[model samples]
Structures are given as structure tokens and as C-alpha cells.
Target: MTRLDTLSARGRDFLGSTHAIMAGAMTWVSERNLVSAISNAGGFGVIACGAMPPHILDAEIAATKALTDRPFGVNLITLHPAMADLIAICGKHDVSHVVLAGGLPSGAAIEAIKATGAKLMCFAPTAALAKKLVRSGVDAIVIEGSEAGGHIGPVSTSVLAQEILPVIRDVPVFVAGGIGRGAAIAAYLEMGASGVQLGTRFAAATESVAHANFKRAFVRASARDALASVQLDPRLPVIPVRALKNAGSEAFAAKQREIANLVDAGTIGLAEGQLQIEHYWAGALRRAVVDGDIESGSLMAGQSVGMVTSVMQVAEIIDELVGEAEAALSNRAA
Candidate 1:
């Protein structure tokens, strides 16, 4: 049998795809074109419904459906003010899979998604949470680490996989973070992961609508160049966002320091100060992705950005990944 045949059946069954690979949802990037392309290429594609209102999400889902009949998923930020409404929108579209990201989901949100008969997938930051999510009736869990782009956890992908994969058997766990090639996917599958998710590697796909400058930054970057945002003050509730280092990252640091100084001087309330810090990154990703302003906008990417050398069609990228994974698995068997 071929190595691709060795992939976990649970994953293939759950995703209803030819392979257990998923193109991680990237804000402003995973739109109709790219999502449909990935699905048509035999992998699962997820739409990143980041902070979009119900109407916009509805259109995006419909647009993607028009492009491909293959299965795809929608990723929703759990803390979005319109979480409930978004869940309803997914149901309206009969979305087959829903991935709740950003944070732990509220019971009402979870129940709402379950009511739609769509499989629920949530990010598991730890082994305990993985078990807890399974008990809460989530159909699957995605264990993503700090090496991933955008907001991230504190642990590394390798460590999180070791800690969670062995303990969770009730639901298939898809590992994400720092995965750039199929060899890494094969390793995780061998370690019992049902599948793998990749974001940075796909962000530069030809199908992605990200501006040429944004994709260029990713192509020129090395793993070391992808750094996580730092919180200058613990009192501030700024979540760390991983991105490529640039003038924008440095400017964010300066903005945080200014906010902290204001709070220390009693010039601004603590809550207001935190909000100011948080708002600094607002629209920054779109600035980079849409406007091609890599200097002053967030170049959100993972350490795997180094591995992305050029923009190819989504199908070509998937073919390369599957081929590499097969070679690795075959070599191991030989």
C-alpha cells in the first residue's frame, strides 16, 4: 500500500477529503479562491471568518461554495461579539465543519454549532483541555502552538503534540504550527496525529489574495525573522501575535511602551490603556495584506515562512506536500 494510504482513517473520515491535510485559515487570505483551490486539490480548506459581520460571512461562504463542491470548513473567532449569529450563518449555509478559534468557546456557542449538525473543532492548548473539549462533545481538536502565526499559545508544536496526542483518543487531533513540508506531516501522523494543519506555507499560494508585497515578505523571510509580538507590561492584556519583524513590529513595541507609560503616570485608566494597546494592531493585518504596506502593517506569518520560496498554485503546493510525505514514508519502510 502507498504511504498516503497509511494516514489515519479517522482523519480522512472526519474531513471527508482524499488526504487528511488542512490549509489553515488565514485572515484576509483564506477567501473563496484559495479555499476552493485547496479543497479541489484534495485537501480540506477552512475559511477564516475573522471579525466579519454575518452578512459578509454569508457571502464569502456562498462564494466559496460556488467555486467547488468539495468539503471545506469555516473558522470563527470564539470571542467575536457576533459569535452566535455567525454560528447561525454557518448553519444557514449548511457548513459541514466549524472550527472555533481564538479562545475556549462558550457553552452557548458550542451548543449552537452542535445544533447545526456540523462537526465542531476547537483549539486545544493543553492535554487537559484536549480531554475537556472531547468531553464537551467537540468532534475534533486542533493542537496549535506558539510557532503559528497571528495569536499563539506559549508551547511549541513538538511539545504540544507529545503532550496531547497520546492522551486524547476520543476525537481525532490535528496538529498545527511550524509545519512547512510533508516530512513533518508524516512525522506527526506517525506519532498518531490524525492530520496536520499549515498556515504560513499556504499564505503565499498563487490563489491567495494577499498583495504581492505581503507574499514577497514571506518568501524573503527566514524562520528566525518570524518573531512573536512582546507584551512590554504584564498589566496590559495584549495577546502575543506572531509575525515577521519589520517597522510595524517595532512601532507596535513603541506604542505599547507609550501606553504603559501613560498608565503608570495615571494619564489613562488601566482598562483604557489596555484597549489602546490592543487597538494598535487593529486593521494592521489588512493594511499589509490588502494595501501591501509591509512596513507599517502586520506581516503575520509563522516560522515556516522561511520554507516558502515562491507563490505556486494551491494544487501544485498540495501535490508537492503529498509527494514529499509519500517519499518519507516509503524511505522509512525501506
Candidate 2:
């Protein structure tokens, strides 16, 4: 086996994929076509169940299954109202792996997904949460740093890796956020990351169903263009989103101000205010990814987006990443 394969054996076996790399789930972009393409390309693909109801997710899983026989996973938002029903849907589909994200999953939700016998993965933003997830019967933990697109925590990928990798050994720990190249993959693997997940690079993949304009925007953007949304009020509790700067970012700031005022005036409860923000993001992302509204749609992208210079096929992307990783390992031995 190649040195890369040897180092990634644990992750490869766990994921039942040729490489330890996983395609990060991006809402509106991670539908059936892209998910199946990633799985077919020898990396793991995850269906983004962002704000999707159970029936839609059920149909999407079935469609992805129809396209690729390779093992792929599904990502479900923990904050969704029908999270339990969504878990049941995954169980019905007999999905090999189920990723719980968007928030810390409840004990019941964890047990419910585990009952389906699917390998369970959850996002851990800190070392303490990583340990807690392992103790709560989580099969794996994905640490996505602040550099990631969409919703993000406060730490960088390197810091999260340093804090969690050596400490969490009982279950495989996957490092994500700002990881776009094989050398970065090799660096994390050397740090004891069982696997790496990338989204921005894959969102521009030729196989992705995202609009042509959306893909173009990604290719044109540099790292500095992707900025995180600021929190207008501490009481509103907005989860910061990372995306390419545009009119949509400014619109979001306005939306936050609107919500904050509503909360201040007792027009909506804190929970309702948060829900409105989530709804707004889901709609805005659809406009950009599905309708080609790049100027005003949410162009969610990670810092690695600057690395995405062009649209490439899924196979080519995976091959390049794997080759880069292999070269990195080989050079280190010299």
C-alpha cells in the first residue's frame, strides 16, 4: 500500500471509501447528483439535509442511491424540527452513516440514530465536546473550524486539531474547515486526524448541480472575500455564517437588525427570531445555488474557495487530492 493509504487505512476502512477524504455537506449544493458523484469518485459524499423535510430527504436519499451503489452518508440538521423523523427516514433507507450537525444532538436523538446501526458522526467544536460525544456513543467526531463555510464555530482548523486530536483517540476524529488540498490533508493526518472533510473545493466541482453563476463566483473569489457574518446583538444569538461578501451579506446584517429589534420589542421570542434567520439563509442559498442569483444570493464558501480556480470533474478533483497527499507523505520520508 502507498504511504498515504497506510496512514489513512483506519479512516478508509471506517468510511468504506478508497480515500479518507469526505465531501463537506453544503446546503442546496449537496443534492443527489453531487453526492453520488463524490461517492463514485472514491470519496465519501454526504447529502445535506438542510431545512429539508423528511419526505424530501427521503426522496433525495433514494435518488442518490439510484445513481451510485457506493457507500454514502446523509447529513441532518440537529436543530430541525423534525429531526427525529429525519433519523427515522435514514433508518428506513438503511444509510451506512448518518451525520448529525447544526447543533449538539440530544441523547435521545443520538440513541435513535444508533438504533438504526448506522455509524454516527457529530460535529465537535471543542475538546470537551469531542470527549462528551465519544462518551455519548458517537462513533466519530467531525471538528469543523471557523474557516468553514455556512454555519461555523470560533476556532480555526489547526487549533481545533491541536486541541482535539491527541485527546480524542477512542473514536476516529475527522478534521474539517479550510482544508482544500492534499498537503493540508497530509498535515492533519500527520497530526492524527483520521480523515479530512472539504466543501468549498467540491462545491465548484463540475458534477455539482449548483448554478453556473454560482460556480463562477467561487472560481473568481479569493480567500479574503469569504467573511463571517457579524452578530448584531448578544441576546439574539445568531450563528455566524461564512460566505463570499456580496449584497446578500449586507442583507443578512439588515435581517439581523430587523430580528434584533423584533426581539427587543417583544414581537417575537428568541427562538422564533433564530428560526427566521435560519429560514432566511435557506432561501437565500437556494437563490444563489439553484437560481444563479450570485449578486444577492448567499454565496456560502469556505476560505479554501480561493484555491478553487476552476470547475473540475469529481474524479479529477479526488485524484489530485490523493496524489498531493501521497507526494506529501513520500517527501516527508526523504
Clash pairs for candidate 1? none
The lowest-lDDT stretch of 10 consecutive residues in candidate 1 is 1-10
Clashes of each: 0, 0
Model 1 Cα lDDT, one tens digit per residue, 96-183: 9999998889888889999999999999999998888998989999999899998888999999999999999888999999999989
Give lDDT tens digits, candidate 2, residues 97-179: 99999788999999999999899999999899889999999999999999999989999989999999999999888899998
lDDT of each: 0.91, 0.93
Identify the runs in model 2 with alpha carbons over 4 angstroms from their true place: none
Q: What is the Å distance of residue 72 in model 1 from its true position?
A: 0.8
The alpha-carbon root-mean-square deviation between model 1 and the true structure, to one decimal in Å, is 1.2
